[model samples]
Target: MTSVYPYLPEMIASFGVERKDVAKWAGATSAVFSVAQSLTAVPWGRASDKFGRKPIIMTGLFCTMCFFLAWGVSTSLKMAIIIRALQGACNGNVGIIRTMVAEMVQERELQPKAFSIMPLVWSVGSVFGPAFGGLFAKPAERFPGLFGNSYFFNKYPFALPNIIGGVVFLISLSTAMLFLKETLHSKRHSRDWGLILGRRITEAFKDRPFRRQQKLRRYSIQDAEASAPLLQTDGTSRPAKAGREKPVAPSMSSVFTRQTVISLVSYTFLALHSVAFDQVLPVFLNYPPQEHTPRNTSLPFFFSGGFGLNSGHIGTIFTFYGITSGVIQFVLFPPLCARFGVLRCFRVCVLVFPVIYFLLPFTVLVENATTRYAALLVLMICKAFAVIIGFPCSTILLTNSAASLSILGTLNGFATTFSALGRASGPALAGLAFTWGVKNNMIGAPWWILGFIAAVGSLPVWMIVEGEGPTAGSSDSSDAESTDAEEEAVVFDDDDDLLDNLTTARRGSGREQQGLLKKGSEDTRNTGYGTVR
Candidate 1:
């Protein structure tokens, strides 16, 4: 996604789009990808549910790598859109990644920090992503010293960035394939050919005898114990049972309970406005430099041209935003969520967005270069902080709202669909608004409109009721019905605990099958809920 951002306008313009229509087409390209994402996120999510998390993740990385390379050499707008749509359709790892994280960090106390990891990684990527998109873009011109005479860089000005992206994806795919363990409890012990083959090759190279190697293995005894029949509480050994009943996927009606619906709706609105702002930033930066008028009292009703930065400069500014945001997220988000509560912090963050949008257009109004840049920096910092807080909070809330782990993939899939629709609409509408505004001499129209949308988005947070974990009791019947008895929760820091627990999953161990430790759920509920006022 970051591979195309910095020079999106130039990229679109190269495809024969009129200068006036480049932004519109750029928005269309992004919207089309999200539209495709909306169509397939559910299926990909369900695939993760049915197959396993690791495989699905690997699949997304591979497909994205291939399609991103296709994106680099696009000859036309339609071709670009087609490649982007294909990319979105083939990749659905986002929700699955969240599901896997939530399962791995089942302890609610750790959720704030745990959930922050994904967005934190995104922030780190944002730092490098735009750098890749910008500095490597049109390298023949940007770095005439090195690539001025090179044929490949000269012929395909934009391909280098995406080539870099594809390499990054390849490395990630290899890493996941070799080391990422499945988090799904049902599939924990399931055979993984990639891991199995990798292990066999490593084992084959060992100089020690097989008997000595087996004796030295730490898990060998544990695996043997797990394979034997589980001992009952009364010291009697129960026969090993066949595959335990797979928990049925909850019906859609059941999954979308009041709290869950609220979470999804709020997330949709959050994605809508947030993505619009993100989409607008690049175009806003790449615009031709215009002299700022001294008549700044017109407020948001009147606005003129942008900072007119080149892709390299834009990349540097974005890198600053990303680095600072990542630091703030890493340093502050967890403690704030822990102290003030996740939902409360999230609600406040959402409320601040409208004001941020209202103030955004003013950045272009300052005529003095030094003052203007300082103001822009402050605003960017504020935006970075709010976004860092808001996103992880949303993830934690939505994750806890799942009816059961058995239904988490489907629920997340459905939620992703809502988010995708919001993302799809954001750019399309913002693009149209931007075009109209630019033509009509109301340059802030899109920003102001998004501000209004942000205000409306804030309304859903008021209606959002936090989802509770299993030990969390409520007088509300809705929450009671949300629980599923058969989906026993087990808190393991890693997959190595699988063998020890497998010995406890016997016919006579129904009571032992309940969540091994239920403290995390209650702690999560208490810490994550609070009044914003």
Candidate 2:
């Protein structure tokens, strides 16, 4: 997916197509692709929630394989565009995959490791996808009989790679179908598309109160011990029959609190800047006609050859940045959050990123090749560090806020929707910004503008409270200590009374009372507040 555009020039030239026409086709196709892909996530997620994960995932993969095959066999540019749009619509696995991983992994501590592994796989895919595309995207003399006399082979030099991609997609689809187990526990599947889509949209808007009510009825009976059977006492008594009725626990509707909305907007802004810079930085750094030569010509060759960052050494450098950021997020950010708290960690990152952005322009001033490379490396490392600091903190803030709203999945969808919006627009915005800057002879202007934007974005985060010191509802400082002591005293008193009651019931031979106590403990455990000690 990442390398699709890299073959645009070759595609235009080989097909004898106008650059403008090709650009328009690509732009419209990509826009439709993005919209369809982004909008499909929630409904797919909802479908997985109802129809079982394996079936939904297998269906998606099968559709994806068909789309890839269509793309591989495309003869005309219009056909290619249609195939890509269908490909986007069918490839709604992002949200489903995340949900599956979450369901499969029980421990939160292991989540970062699982998430990290996916990106590593994707990075490998990204590197090889382009490398293989470039290798296979040559004239038919290179591989004469492989795709002999096919329209795709004649019109599109890159047809081989697409064909291979289609094969891979089919293999993946088959593998998933054979191995993947159902994760969703729902007894009833939602066959109605209208109802499914409506529910998804409603959930996105935090309107799950009616669903909660339906669930609550089932839980209310369970909570009231309606499942327990009545016992009859005759000579050699037997247990009585159970009630047919069960109380349902009411489902609570999630409210979009102000704090959650603010966090979402803030994250959207940050993502806009990050995605824009990610898309544009390589283009800016690798602009044609290299003005500066390295002191050691072998350095670029060595690194580029090893990493396969063919956009000069810049791509390799960015990969390093990505690797560093991922490592830090998995290793460092969690501990920092545990110590200083999520909000404090978030503010610190917000404060630091602007400083890194401000320093980026200085790379242009270093005249010595070694020094310049060193500076660029340091700048990239700092940017990576800022990302490490920012991303997890932002996630923590958003998740915590969502928890308060009691709608974690819907809130996450809202955040993702906005992030997708930013990603969709970021490249165009950067292109315009860069063109304007260059036209105005402001070679160094982008950095300052980025710095100012980052700083402004940070301001909203600071307005939100850092979770430390003597803030209300916090378990920090002497007040919290005193509160903890009181809580402990109450807990001890309750335990003592429970023990007394148990002892009295034993002495009185009242088994029903003991049974009630056991039921109460079980209920407490289910509520997630059970104390081990």
Candidate 3:
């Protein structure tokens, strides 16, 4: 998707759209893709819960690869829209990825670093994607000596970027196919062809006898675990090893608690405006530069102009931002989150977005190229810094709000639907806002609108109650009048359909490791989320 950004206007115009309406066409394609994602994200999440994370992830990657190939060759706007939609339909993997991270890293303290991995991965793609799009689009014209007489290059002006994107997707898909494991507990222990094949391939690289021995040893371990006897809790003489937990149907009624709703609301609004910002920034940069004679306009409210940069320069700018973002994620965000705490860090991140949007139009006024670049660097660095803090912190809170570890995938999936809806609406609204500003000579109109949205998004942050969760087994609660009869009913593991009847304990509690280790254990008592192994 980032690969398409640099050449999106050119791509749309090649299909007969007028220069004035290219933003509209671009928005249409982007909107269609997001709408498709919105429709499928929840279903895909549910499928990950029911089937397994690895399968859905592989399927998404495969679909994305196909979409890239198809989109590369699209001859008309209609074809572009269709292919983009298909691309969106397969991209419900983000939530599943988050779910896996939450499951894999159980400690609350480690969550900021863990969740930051996805955004960092995206930053890597953003850096390369824009570079590819800018440098490679319309190769026939850019490098006529090499591609001038090639019919393929002439007919498919935008093919190079998509081809590169396809190759990247293929690499990711291959990696997932060979090594990715199923994170869903219930679906785990089932045969994983990827891991098995991965082992076989690795062993094949060794000497023959070494390979055979490794395979034999591997099989012995797996077979012993598979054949392990179930532990008896009845105090019988039979001493047995731990065995697979019986599968239980996950219940969803309790998933959407008050905290969950609050988190989703903030997440949705954040998605809405941030996506709009991304859509409009390049278009704003690509707009015509203002002349020496200034128009009769008020400061901030009435303005008409842009950075007037070409695709290559614009892509380089975005690539710079991507690198800066990765740096901030690695060096800044985690430390700040750790020192100040996730909620405080999140609130500070949320509060600054409106200011960022408000300042964007001012960058257009600078005449000196160096000054303008400096301004952009500052604005984008701030934006990246905030984003790096916001997304991971938000995800951690979202996971905290989940009623059961089992429902993390479902909760993330369910929430992704709304975020996808926000993304769906963002491009179209931004296009309209940009168009309106162009006609009205108030180039800052879209910025103001987005600023308002960011302000609105900040509202729910205050309402959110951030903690590890509703901590279970805390002795500090004031319930002086309560007796044994008034105590919360004990829930046995066998009795809980969600497989998690109680909440996770306070962060840093000793029970955190216990709850994580005992996951999916059949004989595990109905203990609070804090105690397990």
Candidate 4:
């Protein structure tokens, strides 16, 4: 996205729009994409629950391919907007993929490790995508020695990046088709072949015979009776009562407890703040230092307050950020999570956002280029750390908050929908805010606004109550207490049953009963406790 930021003015100008409206159109275009994504994220998540994770993911990949192709060939800003929106509508895979990862790792303790893959993978892609866009975009124009006078290159100067992006998506789709596993329990038992062709052929061969032989098994009361070996009954006394009843688990409705609600709200706010920051940063960085006088040309440049970087420069910076982000996600995050625990780690990360935002504008104050770059790099690292930390932790907490395993899909879907809302609003608002700040000659205004948002967003994190321990999600407190009480009561109940059976045996034999009674009385006197007697 940063790669394309440098070209937005050019892209907009080709549509014959006024220069002043570029920011507005940029924000609008991004909003359209988010709006589409917001509308479909929940539905896709629901579909993943009903169908399976792999299929949903593959569908998203296919949509991404289409999106890139169309975006590359776009003749006008309107086409780009529609294509982007289409892509968003079709590619609602974020939550579904999160669900897949959570389900993939059964052991609760290993989940953090598994979840760390997501951010790392995303960072890697972020690095590559912008690099591709920055270096490959407008290839016909930029690389005339290679693509000069070629019909394809001449007709679609900016199509090279899109073509590469599409191919990448295709490769990803192929990989998914071959290696991705179905994590949904219901879909798991249905034969999976690890590769598309093998699965198809296997299903084709199995379908006829499988259906022909399929028959429902019926339950039998006789089977139940045969399985239960009878306990002896004493005629001298009544039959022993049953053991204590087992504890019932909490209902699905119990998932919406105060802690869970607070976590969700906090997560949504975090998303809003994080995404807004991300959207604003690139624009701020690419913008030239503030200009005192109007220029003859309408090309984009940083004003006095901006970084004044080209697309390639911006891409290089993002590449650096991405590499560092990957390291932090994979190497640093797990230990941090282990050392500080997920909630504390998340809270600390949240607190860092405001600090990062506040410090970001200060980079412009540095007079030396090298010093400014160094300072900016450090700030970017901190920002990446802040951004990456909250997501995985929030995902863990969300999974933990599930009322039942069955409802994980629904809960994540709801989370994705809320997140989509934030994503949709953030970029648009950020663009507008930056534009407003620049036009009003208050360059720090956007930063200040963002800082406030981050600070306010952090407040909700305090309300999230961490679970007791690793086994916290297994059951609730009331159920645990009930289970303990039931277990304690079972010993007496078993003794009563055994005593009744002994009494029945005594009743059957009169001489034996008298002898046994005498022995029992002697034993009871000696032990001063009930036993076989």
Candidate 3, superposed: residue stretches over 4 Å from native: 1-4, 206-218, 222-252, 469-533
Determine which window of 10 residues in candidate 4 has minimal summed lDDT. 217-226
Q: Which residue pairs collide, candidate 3? A: 514-532
Residue lDDT tens for model 4, 1-533:
32234445445556777644555567667677767877888788778777777888898888778876877778887788898888778766678887777665646567778888888888897788777766776777778899877888677666787788788888888888765667664454343444445344444566665643321111101111111122222112122222211223234366466666787787887887787776567667767765344442121323336787766777778778888989899889988888888889899989998898777776776778899899999988998998788889988887776655555666677677777777777667777777776776555556667788889988988887765322345333345346435433211122234345446657866887767655544433442212232
Give a tens-digit lDDT track for model 2, residues 1-533: 44233443344334555522333333344445545666776566556554556677788877877776666556666776677667766765554664455445434454345444454454455455545555565436456776556666776666676677777777776566444444432211213333334334544566467566333222221211112222122112122212111112112334255666677667766766665555556545543322334431222111110111223255345555555655665577567666766678777877776777666645654557678678877877776666556654665455545332113334454566665555445444554555554444344444556666778888789766432111122111234246435443212122234345435544654777566545435533343111211
Residue 418 of model 3: what lDDT?
86
Please provide the root mean square deviation of candidate 4 (C-alpha atoms, Å): 14.0
Residues 19-74 of candidate 3: C-alpha lDDT, one tens digit per residue: 66877777778888888888998899888877888899999889889988888889
Model 2 off-target regions past 4 Å?
1-33, 58-88, 91-93, 100-155, 159-182, 185-255, 290-342, 356-366, 403-409, 443-452, 463-533
Model 2's number of clashes is 14
Off by over 4 Å in 1: 1-4, 196-215, 218-247, 292-300, 470-533
TM-score of 3: 0.83
Q: What is the lDDT of residue 176 in candidate 3?
A: 85
TM-score of each: 0.83, 0.57, 0.83, 0.74
